[model samples]
Target: MELMILLSLIGAVCSADITAFGQFMISRPIFCGPLFGYILGDIYTGLWLGLIVEMMWINAIPMGVSVPVDLTMMTILSVVWSCTAFQGCQEAAIFALALAIPFAYLYSEVDLGGRLFNTKIMHWIEKGIEQGKEYRITQGIFIGLFLFILRAGIAYFVFFIVGGIIFKQVYSFLPYEVVYGLKKAWYYLPVFGFGAVMYNFRNIKIPFLRK
Candidate 1:
């Protein structure tokens, strides 16, 4: 329970790093995956999961008004769920990865909603500024930050608890064939991720090299 809370807090901070606060690469799966793994005492699992996720989503960038799936949340949740529930089980980690991907997209939607709400706060700050009240700007910034962290923290906490339970229960029921396939995927997924990375790089138009 305590570990869950700590992970949720970490998730909140990392989630906020996506755009709400620091644009530091701490939000990247490569960093957070190992961090979560180390915290849960499974650095190897964390490292592999992070590397796979980072490579797989190499091109998932947030540009302009677009919101990409939250990779940090996906990676961290997978690491936390797998490590806590199944520790060092590669098959379980892969299954957790499958589960976390959709949740990442869902969180993206939730993040979009939060951004929409932020517009209201922005307008409120604008109104205050026009009326000669400068203090609203600071208040609005803090409020926005607080709300962002709160939303992420709550989401992480719920998913950690609920998702962990679901992963343990469902994984126990998986057939031997399915488990075998997942174990196979444990090796193949990294290669798949490598292919994804190469594909993304292939599409990159180097400015000086562009025709």
Candidate 2:
């Protein structure tokens, strides 16, 4: 449990880095999933989860002021729940992904609010500039970044606990038919994910198909 908590916090920081500081691709599930998995001592599970999420959300890009749902948080929460709560159950992993989507949307709202608050910080820096205090620029950046990490960390920590409990309980009550379906989806969903990825990258058209 402690290890899972730590991994969730780390996941929050790395995910935040994508937009907050680094803007590196590390926020993508391809990187984020395996990271939490590795930290939790289950790299393959993480790899599968990451691949599924990356493909499923291949088109989730932030354009203009529109914030997409937080895929990174989804990946982290799903992976953590699967690894810790279910521990290598493919059906549980799929269920975990299903469970994480709503939470991801919640985080998206949080992210939007955070950005709005950062704009206020930007105003403070602008005012400081007029007063010849150049240090406010650095101060604002540091403060914004700290808040970003804190917000993400806290969200992950809370969700990891609550989500894990819910995941275990909900999964335990699932009927055998539902569990069987989830198991099948565990393999079949990836094919759909890959197809979605390929379609996004290069829409392959059949020769006989009418455009």
Candidate 3:
């Protein structure tokens, strides 16, 4: 219980890097996965899962008005669930990944809603500026950051608790064949990720280098 709270808080802060604050790559799955793993006492699973997610979603970048999947959430949830529920189980880790992807998409929508709300704050700040209340800009910025972290923390806490329970229950009932397949996928998914990454880089257009 205490661990969950700590992880949720850490996740919220790291998630802020996505857009709310520093654009450091700490939110990237490669970093997030291992971070959660280290906290949970299974660095190998964290490293492996992080690498797979990083490669698989290498192109999921947020640019302009396009919002990408919350990869940080995905990686954090997967690592937390897998390590807590079935530590060192590659198949279970993969299953957790399967579950985490949808949650990531769901959180993306939540993130979009948060950004939309920030637009209203933007208007409020603009209005205050016109009224000679320039301090509202700083206040609004802090408010936005608070709201963003609050939503992220709440989401991570709920999902961490709920998803951990679901993963344990569902994984225990999975058929032998399905488990076998997941184990197989545990090896193949990284290969697929590598292929996907290579494919994504195929059309790279460098300024001073040939394509």
Choose 2 or 3, whichever is better by lDDT.
3
Full-model lDDT for every candidate: 0.91, 0.88, 0.93
- Tens-place lDDT digits, model 1, residues 44-82: 999999999998899887889888899999999999999
- The residue ranges of model 3 lying beyond 4 angstroms of the native Cα positions read 204-211
As for candidate 1, its clashing pairs are: none
TM-score per candidate: 0.94, 0.91, 0.95
Deviation in Å, model 1, residue 17 alpha carbon: 1.2
- Give RMSD to native, each candidate: 1.9, 3.5, 1.8
Clashing pairs in 3: none
Which model, 1 or 3, shows the larger TM-score? 3
The runs of at least 3 residues in candidate 2 whose Cα sits more than 4 Å from the true structure, single-residue gaps closed, are 1-5, 201-211
